[model samples]
Target: MTFAEITTKRGDASDGMATGPLGRAHVRADGPAKITGRATYALEHAVADALHCVIVQSTIGAGRVVSIDKSDAEASPGVHLVLDAGNSLPLVPKADFFGNLPPGDTFVPFATEIRHNGELVAAVVADTVEQARAAADRLHITYEEAPVVATFADPRAGDGNPVEAMSKTWGEAEQALAEAPVSIEVRYETPREYNVPIEPHGLIAHWEADDRLTIHEPSQWIDGMANQFATWFGIPFENVRVVSPYIGGGFGSKGQALPHSAVAATAARMLGRPVKLAVTRPQTFTAHGGRPATWQTLKIGASEDGRIVAIDHRGANETAAAANFVETLGVVTSMMYAVPNFRSRQTIVPVNTVVPGAFRAPGKNPSAFALESAMDELAIALGMDPVELRRRNEPDVDPENGKPWSSRRLLACYDAGAAAFGWSKRNPEPRSMRNGRQLVGWGMAVGTHPVYSSPGEAMVRVLANGRVEVLSSAIDMGTGTYTILAQTAADALGVPVERVEVKLGDSRLPRAPVAGGSQLANLMVGAVHKTALAAREDLIALGLSDPNSPLQNQANTLIIEDGMIGPPRGPAIPLGDLLTATGRDALEVTRDTLPEKERTAEERLSMFTSLAGMERGPGIPKSRHSFCAHFVEVLVDEDFGTVRVSRVVSAVDAGRLYNPKLADSQFKGGIIMGIGMALLEEGITDPRNGRILNANLADYLIATNADIPAIETISVGEPDYDATPLGGKAVGEVAIVGMAAAIANAVHHAAGKRIRDLPITMEKLL
Candidate 1:
């Protein structure tokens, strides 16, 4: 029922609060409810008198609507509204390029487009989903099909103009690479990656009036949706409400605006009713955008002393017909390693494919695979340990700019991670480490993600009954935002966790940055901190004004803690006593926090432009990168060619491990995703036609009940307090970064083949 309601007791609360009471730490804030299957997800919601809507997607990859034969659907019992390309109204117009879709890797949807497959060509709103689906099948539509380009293999095919552009750059390119002493070059590519958040994108919309719309959807953003809907529909920001109590997962899929949300809202408006539209599992691929595949060529040169001399990385990939979105694959080389002569370019071509968007790490995973793979190759060429080679070439400042890091311990991370992972225990020779039928190789890679956090506001109301409700617009996309916010409020208000009631996922409460860039804690902490302080001041003021209460004269000399206010050296009386004495209700406070604007402004002005939009570690004296060394043990049957990851040890440093249990779980999830990416994950395309072959789950295999290994993740870092209030960088992306490489390296060690490509298919070994 609640964290306090859990009956299992381990010990006492002396060890500074963890999971359950005392030393028990919940793997996640909402772990109990999730495991018990009591948590409510979007599609599980049941609103009063809500109608159902189902989308009918186009089978062809590219096409234009010729005719909509919807008579059969309209005539069906309980069928209400049918939306197709002809009658649809976009939340954002076709001409205006602005709409919230999460920052970076920009793409538009429903803008004079039939860009990709599974698009919502038509949708029928009916009394029930089953009725809607049945009715939809009866209606027929004609299409004038256009030739599709679903794969990146062809460079010459696209819609409108050929789209290509590098997001950012630096240094003289052709001149330096031609002059290097030793050089190496290779090509790297990665296929499409879906977030595969168990909760498919969907929305329930209730339009009480044309001006008032309430939405219950699975989202990582509540305030984001509020602002977006407010701006898009020209309605007052306060009129639109969003609610999400629990989210199965987001990864990147559930961030912001989608066409289905608009569809549900439109359905509610068309009929004076509430409408629910949850995408079918398979429809998520075409209706929602995902990480597109990428191809990169890296040419690196180094001196005899293990110093990097030059690097040239050029890349290209396909985006959707609606918009060209390119992942900056070469951004890391300019900043990750110390290289003077480095130049890179990223070109994105608009294909008749689904628009590429954010996956877990977005551009970083594929980029790291190529960059780290080449680094390992360089280590082999130099006859040096890969760990030592990276250590030897560390930068004194962020290479992208000459600026300092806010806080950096990459060297410490490498040294500590290597030692912990037992890097010295393994043989450097690829085929040396062996256990009867399996070869084991250990590999390490460095990953750096920005420590980004924005501003947030929180409202704290102390009720007459001594209960406190802290309201925030921050939501938990299965990352424990709810518990963390409650914890922060409890600690601040000097109340027990049970007494602190947290209200989240409501835009009517307060504004917060979308839960992307790993900034939830950073964005929320400031508001919670200030609001708590204000509540304390209010309590103190109340005590001073009244003379009858024990705290009246003592307010100036007293401190408040655990709902008590009294002298620092003596027993403090409960706040409820003071309220009882005065016959008053309770204290209330609200505060809005803007991130130290000066800090954001300064970073913007001082950041390196040559590295293309990526922030150089500003304010630190050394090059900043988060590091992790993965140790994977694999069991491969010589006959089957299927290598199973038996065990994995990942040592990482993203700064502090906030909730060790939660942090560990995050790493474990990363390891599993990494295993899938390394061994089984790939979106296959048919060679005959550009259609995606394994678009469904049954065709594309993933790590499931049987494949997960016993993963042990050890985090190393004293904490980077200067980075943020909680002292953590983006921990979510880095684990998956070098993860695929480590698993690949292990596979190579086992099979004696260097398979550089991902989803290292068994055919390569067979």
Candidate 2:
């Protein structure tokens, strides 16, 4: 099974047969509308008589509010109401993190107790956004500040608790490390990062009546948001509606409902009017979670022949004092490679900051940095080619649970990427490759992310006019969800791509999993595929039973293609004509894909405990993961010590690609984000006051067009049918997993400088 084989099975219109779109490079359906500014985002929706709301944040990091004087704000012009602890809707306590029980204190916004700086304290609703901002500024508040433990480095920071179920030891790691002939130990640090999507978090909450709440917001998890609001307000779940047709970008930031959304909903209900709140650029840093700061120390031992004998990874990540969200630093460590003995310990260090949440690869990003960099170091110790070292340690079964892999084509990716990037031309010696006062270096590393799928439901309708519509609560988030889903329905229904329509990001539609973890593609596509097949079968049955139909009782030889149904090789009849003959306007079917339904409640809870994938155990006989290899070239200036990634070749094995064009873009996007993590992006927190110094885009750096290099992406491997019915795995996040390490290895090769800390800035090189 290879990419070539996958391409052959892709649907073909040439032979007059209908098949699902599996490996096509179709353009995004939403691109034209988005580029022309005709697409409506969450904040772009219009509502009559909607008041604007602005939030006031706490100045102190940890404290108790002494007093709040809202008199001036109440008297301000156009101020409809000022909501604070003194007067706000009381919310019932619900299980944290979408009802997945965890050991942590649950909290809501508009509290008098300050947990961290920028905590939501009050909100002002007025006739306009400017008036709301003015009133928010006029509110006088005083706080009795307490001492703050800002980060993992703070002396007051606790030793932290071991992450439950995440920390485990297999075999005798210490004994194996001691007996191994070769070994290396290294510590790597990654700084706090924020998900500053193009469109900041915003919401417009409206109460149509006392019991009904409607929110037009950008949400990655529509059903979760509706359920959360329903739980908070003690209303029926059906009464809460979440409508998010389009989003600017999410990158995991919009997966969960933050406190600001709650404040807006509260204000809207209190004022008896609609309230719109757009989180400012700076507030987005603390309003929702991002990638947490991590400290990882890895000890790897190998034989002289480069076979990994032992690996011990111990790490800590910063979480909020008010929440329990630990970065699973051992996510990729336990199963990435073939190590006979493995040990991992993950600790959660509570800091005076916002609770960290998902950011793209989340746990795997930082974990891969440490483990992959350590592998590079081990390769240096063994005097072996990095690619060869990885090939030698490739596992036959999952090292964590001894399960066979559904699909493991990582070596193929390495081969493809290395050949494309001209790896054989490289000189492995550090600082040996030079060109005109600049040093060139080539480096490569393994990339991986787990495959996850939750229950998803979708509705497919084939109209009498020969058009198809697929509806689901899943969102695009600029990931081509609409395009791929439409393609899936069109392929399944034997129709042209142009005749399929996709409607998503609304709770009123069929339910879907959250758009994070790269799981929506598998779940939603499978649901659409099933429902479309059922609809086609229903239509064919109608044609057989209809007395006026041209082809009755030809079930075995019937074929549906190009919106026409007939016996193979003859007498094709239009689908619209059959529907008219049957006295039916359309055929519709709704279906769901529930892969995890057999798991117990406890097992289900463990799946989303920290946004990691399902645990490998006896019930699951196969370990599923998407694999890639990144070959990076970096240039180092002789005088200034600035490093730039000149080019990248990322070869990915994500089962079967539904849309190669979109997959190509997703690969490049993740690589560019990896560049930011390696050389540019860092959230500078003022430890003294627990304030994020670089909160705005001007201060918080990201990879722009000027920083990007030429990126080449190659798709590899066959469809992993064992993992999912669609034969596709997670695609987006794995590209960023090993990127930072590859760039760091390139830096060391170019300048002979090893900087363990993230954002390998010029000062460290100099």
Candidate 3:
């Protein structure tokens, strides 16, 4: 069904949800508080008797900590204590990039050795944040520097034991390349970029006299932090109460309990005082996981008419020697499209850099650029329409799934996006459309986010007064998760939106998964839907059996509409009637949706994972994720070496869209970020010094408000219901998939030059 042609609308006035008689709810929950700026984010927290904990970072990329003299800083006013890594005992170790979970010894931050340029070398606590910052600058450090492998220029030279660092194998790629009808071989590089979430990283720890530590920080996952802190700090999980009531944003960096967060808490526990540490903007790019620098080589062999035969995708990402974190980009190259004779490989090249972590689409953000750009070029080479080319190769089943898609809407996406963007009217000639001095171009792309689910627990409480309160640990990251969850609760309880209150983002609340990977909705809403249903059923039974209320013996069927639980047969009666008759304030119910993996295991080991989601610690059935079709329109001023993304139309089919407005935001954000990855954003690290330079918002360019043209988002929502109870999929991460390439293809259409390297920098065009 078409996205905008609202057919089934079932919402109420209390929440501005649903359509027609009733549809989805309105933007409830945090809308007014957020728009008015009265809400408190994690960074704005105030803790009594808290000392400012300032982090001192490394100056060099790779080196041994030769000497650390802190006498000068220790003597400063307001200075309470200083902590190097040496002070943090029970050094919790984790798995390196290649999966060889390693252990540490004497990691005395500037005590013995330095690893990456931004590595946390030391921390200081003082009366004020400024004082801590000032005293931290007084630290004297001397290091024994070593040669830094900062790039993927030489794979083997940069990565030790290439065999184990990057596992790779495939068919006879060399032989196929020789006999191809038409072959395109290109190397694409996407520079490391920072996720400049509006809220800077900060932590405030409150260590109670009772040995229980309460931390107020900005994290997407409080339970995950509870677990991480407990594991790393060598403390009982119960003692660590992570409270992140609100967060500005977490692209992907806030998924885990950050290293500095751990260090700050450990220092507070050891020093016997509360500690507050906040990273500077420059420090943010270094300490937190930045998008790793990528160097990819994609080889596509196609027939004379532009049909791809063999696809070989090989790439390596620059990561930290201290922490090996690899965001594999070759997955799409292997799975996307219908090229079966394909193989992929990923190599993690250890560079003198901070550990890289998940950032939005991960590899698909870049790989889609590479693969889609090639497909665009292939279309141009064969004089065929790019949309038709993609349509020709659209696979019926998840080649990886070995099963048909519950429903695939790539064709629908292509058609819908094309119609919206006016793809049919564009001229196929270079610099064909012109308005005055501007050489106008239009571009479109396909967006596809995979399915991601983590374990989550939700508590649905029907108050004694017939009110609904959903206690959840999930955080809303610029997405309308709060409203959507409330909708599910309302729909399930058969109550009005006013009666349902969703209390989320608190550790005290039941554990919910981190709000990322487009998994927040999938993980949190199902349990709520089920729980609400149960509550409604229970209330109905109570009314039937009690016979003390108007709802009893009415000889009518009643469904919860708005907040009334009256009869379909009699005069409408609000659910509040039961509470009044019973002389109660509210009723409550709570249930937990186990991670799909474990819950599915409880069922027969069917071909698909259980409709329920799963938590970490392995054994989850990693199914073949969802897919989409992207088309972009770009206007390239060829002579000026400049491009403007005039329009972007993205079509995605991410299972069932519980709320269209919410889903549209995901698609828009994805395409917009993709445009940045293609044209503007990149984190530049110095090759000579192994230091990341563009570490702040000013130097690193993301899409400004003006940079984004009209983004037309189309969703083939829930055409596929293979692995999800709601017939849903992960839509956030893959929304920008193939976004850049669509622009690149449009660039070719307007400028007739294929600029392989990023940004299509002016120099390259000139």
Candidate 4:
């Protein structure tokens, strides 16, 4: 209910314009709480008489549980209960956040059959977490092993099923490629990557009654998961309450209800005691999904002048047999350039592994790696500068659907990024530029992600004490969502940010869409604006109707500025005074809003089935997308095969800057993740048994402080009115798109070796 003190820098407002703290950089309202350890994350919520639950996992990759001997664990001291497939309560299968049956729903926990390794076999509840873990270890389990198809490369795992929805061909790509003067054909592969958030996945389930359930879990989509949980327990949706005030990080992993949560809730109801379950860091690998492994074969044909002629891309990603959550790689490939002939086919390879979920950029990230790397190869085939090649193929309209862009400044991004990164000083010849014994190289790639806004709701209340409260269910995944939403509400209500209190991450708050795909800002901002506007109007009406009001009978030109309501060029009365005179304690308004335009049936279906945003719909003549260009510098050791990212300069065109400081952090964070993708991070799975070898942080390498270098982010664009009322696009995912490709291209320029596969490792280079 409380936020840290907000720091704001205010400027003088004009007579008609209210220059509140909307675009200015303000300190985060939750900074003090987080730094001082006052912010409560999911597992940190303590409940009285709460028993700890530990899940026993199946050892075999793919198998059927023959028998589970839980008598020893049940008899252990401090053990409350030991529940397995034999004694588990029946739960309903519910749809996931995207309206599809995820593995958590399709494959019930404690079931006899196991789809993959680490499948939940039993749940042990005890007085303490240590006791639960000890009891879980005492349980003996036997499994009948089955042949496992671990990955797409396995011959047993046949060619994956074609994702018919993602397959598309506009022109004769084969014929165009055959006749083109310059063509390049290559294959790229991105390995599985895990989301290693600072805080692991955890949940506290307290069942007040058989019909009533309350869950305290970290979530990105509170409303979506609350409904899913209600369905699972066969309880009234209104009876289920989900509270998540803060999340360390989600990155799409916490967007839906996992099987572990359901098991904990069931345990709580059976024991008549609250249950707390925290997935260990090692268990997180198989407990939730991660970025799936993908293989893409790309063929690009270009003219002598460096214009792209044709693009043929066939992509496939690994998925769990129980869940058909495939990455649609064609979305980014079809629209990136102005190719006359373009063809794409996406497939999902069902393997005995954990179900794949959305990563930061999801399908778009690997797709960008394939497409942009191919573009760089195409540039090499035509002997053209990569930047110039992209410029030559820049499209006036979207090649996939023939729609104009809301605002595309890709060329401008390239210019700005190149200038900032000193692109002009680079030598064109491979391995020609060097610093001492190390080779120096410069590389660049274009980045783009669709702008999306879902239907959202917000409640705004203006109290007579000159205080404002903005309430929503949308959660911030360390993306500055709280700060940005507060700024938006304060700007619209003509109040200082310090007086505004923002409440979020609770299912009981006004409904909101999932805070993924970088869509929350546009979604909640509009809702907050509308609700604030309504409240402002109510205050103005109260002032105009009051007989003693100084602004009586001035409804025609009444305006609110600096917490004051009056005529545009005249003296104003304080909003608190109007409320005091009217004997009203507060003015409250709740607004449920849709996107700027109505979504088409197709768009709505896409939203439910896929994480993709609106592509073509009514009242949307333009294709709304954010664009950026990343210029990277790299140094390669000739003998040790070590690659280091020296510096990076990324210029972005994500429309108006809401919070420059936050945006810069987002951009640099993504670049650091890109650095990891290029040289460090990889999820190693044993193909023999489908077991993740590097599940723990000690083995799973990510970019550390020593790995990161100087990164500069420059914003370049005006307000895009066609996108949203706030005039801003998605910045979260766009910064990471095409980033890996930029680094790979730089490696090729430095070492004269085109390592097409991802994570340009030392052995691969050697």
**Candidate 1 Cα errors over 4 Å, as ranges:** 1-27, 89-113, 158-176, 595-626, 687-690
| TM-score for each predicted model, relative to the true structure | 0.90, 0.95, 0.90, 0.95
Give the Cα error of residue 253 in candidate 3, in Å.
Answer: 0.8
- Note the Cα lDDT for every prediction shown: 0.69, 0.84, 0.69, 0.84
**Weakest 10 consecutive residues, lDDT, candidate 1?**
605-614
Tens digits of lDDT, candidate 3, 589-703: 6666653434443242211112224332134343436566666667666568778887776777776677676677777887788778778887887876678778888888888
- Global Cα lDDT for candidate 1: 0.69
Clashing pairs in 1: 19-24, 19-25, 19-26, 396-622, 404-619, 404-620, 405-620
Q: Residue 604 deviation, candidate 2, in Å?
A: 13
Best by lDDT: 2
lDDT of 1 at 157: 60
Q: TM-score of model 4 relative to the true fold?
A: 0.95
Candidate 1 residue lDDT tens string, 389-482: 7887787777777766666667767766666667788677776777777666666666656666566778887766767778877788777666
